[model samples]
Target: MRLIFIIVVATSLMPISAAPAQAAPLDVKGGYYHFIGDEGGDVDVTAQAAVLRNMEALTQYRSIADGSTFPGWQKEWINNLGPGVDRNFVLELNYYGAGEPTIPRPQTVDGVVVPAPDMTIQQRPGDTWKWAYGYRQVTSGQVDPLLKRALDQLKTMPYAETVNIQLGSEFDTDHEFGTTENGIAHGWAASDARALTAVQYIIGYFRSHGLPAGVTFSIGMGGWHRASFRRMHPEWLRGDVQVLQWNAYNHGTPRTPYQVFNRTRAWAIEDLPRWRTKEVVIAEWGTTANVGNQAVWIAGAGAAIKRINTDGRGFRIGTLTYYDNDPNWGELMDRDAGLEALRSVYTARPFIG
Candidate 1:
């Protein structure tokens, strides 16, 4: 489930070729996590993409159930981008959140149906949030039709020159999608195993059916939560998956670029072994309206990334995108300060293949 309230926003992977004596220079791409126009907002998708040309952008291909259908706005959003655009499209295949895995007599808030807990995954110790789940059905082949339809839809999209299909958003965060069965909460380790299996299955399914030339697939989580999962299950970062992705936000007290991206820098340079060999993406990152130094943070964000790319660190920190197009959070509208801050980064370090 994508964080619709506090949000941010994959690809078929290239085979991991044997490492060259000296890897190519890191090219850190820039873009946003969501496009407002696609969500019935006033912004124009084409115009927005044009401004951030040659960068990576994000949108969702959502499904609420095993057989849930694509919404009207999804097709319109794809059509708006058209063909021959220089941007990379990251179509997040989001499933089951906020009124999903339906249970009896769900409560409604603000005229919206509250989603029932997924009983497939059991709750574990230290779990605080009720939304976490392992997506067992998806990986178990119970929803092949829905997954296939999403791939087919992307294949027909003229705008998807380079597509990255992220399997689901932030599942590793224990509390966000924990498992439960019949009112009983169980341990989390089993669900964790299930989550990893689901990723492996999704990757194989995509590989077998295939994506377009530049498209690939990956799984994502909160940057803070990923290290724990990776440590316990080293296999999470291995195999056919070529990208290391996570949502990066400055939710703590306001932070400097160095402070904010420092963890990412560590992951690339020291903490995560073999991370240097894969593409690392800060899938979602931004400052809040009250952060005071939004422009500075925004500008510093890009500069920090650029420094990593050029510092001869052998790190592949590609794609530093913001949360969204709304003004309330890390908005990047025409008049917003974040837009210029990001544009400067894109201008200085142009997007490359």
Candidate 2:
């Protein structure tokens, strides 16, 4: 009688959550993905993963950014997560900073070397730093020289499989185009338009090279911001966007906040579908500070990445990158065990087969 009772109770309890899912292999047609940032899972495979390196040529100069300290500055992971690299891991093509930042070292024109301060180099939200100062140079045609230099260097490096630009985190820091009050997702901001034009040039540049054969630009928003943009910029929703992502940085209180449970309900169910992006993802999400327990929370978030039913084709979530802050912000994984969560997710991250 006791055994029967115990067995019945165990079976009666329902599963709290499902294990995190991985993305499907993306083709020209586009389908399911698994960089499940919504659930805090990722698809970073060091060998097969796409790591963004700094364009040394650009950062070598200091005016654009302190070549020695800022820009591609790499840092130690919270738990010494995978291939220990510093904070300088952004996909920013270096060598373009014949003046201050990025790589590939462009050639001189008219005996002058200046990294056009107009071209924008985007970073995650709430931070300061950019590719250029404003659209002043972009419209002046100064970006042409820098663009030429960038194209030259990109050709020599390892081919980037997908260049995913998860938009919306551009929450107006001191960067050039981002300085305006217009929300990053506003879409009508002049600076935003210039950035779009620049990105189009970048896509055109790469497509001409045959490396990626195509280019993908991604954008994301949190529940709060998503509502604002949807009402303000209804036209922002379109079929052109290849990768649509979501931000899941559940922050505030206790330094590092526990996410998963809330995210499953928020990102998976509410936010993703409301945005109607072709590919759904939690582009950036992680707990801040807290050491010993970070691993569990991070992994839990991954496991909790629940899938939602939609009308479009079925697909997995895309990458869920752990947001690592360089320059040692108190909230970052500077010297703690928080990285274990990040490592576990990537280690067990799903593949696109």
Candidate 3:
């Protein structure tokens, strides 16, 4: 208002003259902001692409500060520029996110009576790690006990502001979860009626139990079952799944860098939106035996993350979390070689949620 008033008064006082108007300072509050840092030494594409086109400004911002890790550097960046002056800041992290909601009675979908669920996901930005509530199979009779146990554990430790209710490890599709019948875990697959019911139950439980308001839930499923199931019930898209925690891997015995890139991209970009999920994530992605040339594959993967705006709503890929736990199949990423490979990307584009 002050700037506008001054301009109006000055205009009235001065005679009409040939003078160029001064440009106003930008209000960075509402603009496109991207996070280029890591939470725990994850991949950073912004650093690897020294000459990344359309990203020089971001690159320059990062160059001025130095820190042992991303969090360290982020503090420095904020001190230098101050918050809200620019639309970029480390996302407000939540340590004790509420567990899922209670599962309600099953509802009919496509004329087939299926379990009904209720849930919601926050669509902000931050890099996250989906630690498995751990189990090869879904344990117990109802979804409440299993979910309650996990929530109890989360209550003990409060650090992460976001939690992704990932379904079955990338390899488990037997649906060995919930009330089983005669040795079969039925209906709880991602696209199945029970899976949706379970997710909604968890969300309701969280609401009733009272987890912090800032905490958020990011729930989704893995396997061809859920993705394939979406075809029969497209209306499922109108639900509260915040991020698509789908897993993608190239199982070829001797995969090359480009091959790995292509495979990863197909899942994160090419295949995810078919389900109509707005925020996407490659919850589990990596190569086994031939985790091919880490830097090369990561850069290739970054290319897909960089170009993800198909629906015209600025639908960008939010995060890429690699499967680093299973030692049975892939190269141990904990080793220096893998860490270094990861560093290249982390150094380039550090973080996202």
The whole-model lDDT of each prediction reads 0.53, 0.37, 0.36
Expressed as tens digits, the lDDT of each residue in 1-353 for candidate 3 is 99999989987887756333211111101111123233332223333233222221111111001112122323343223322121111111111112222222332323444222222112123622221221211222233443444455445433323333433332223232322332333333432454444445555675677544444444433434445434223345435444444455545565553454334335434444554445544454565645455445544554344333232323244555444434433444444555455544444432321
RMSD of each: 10.0, 13.0, 14.7
Tens-digit lDDT track of model 1 for 60-137: 434423232232233465455544322333332332323433332233333544343244431345643344222555
Q: For candidate 2, which ten residues in a row score worst on lDDT?
A: 53-62
Q: Candidate 3: worst 10 consecutive residues by lDDT?
A: 23-32
User: Which candidate number maximizes lDDT?
Assistant: 1
lDDT of 3 at 258: 40
Stretches of candidate 2 exceeding 4 Å from the true structure:
1-133, 162-194, 205-211, 219-224, 227-240, 253-277, 280-283, 290-292, 308-316, 326-336, 347-353
How many steric clashes between backbone atoms does each model show? 20, 41, 40
TM-scores, all models, native as reference: 0.70, 0.51, 0.48
> How well does model 3 score by local distance difference test?
0.36
Residue 345 displacement in candidate 2 (angstroms): 3.3
lDDT for 331 in candidate 3 is 40
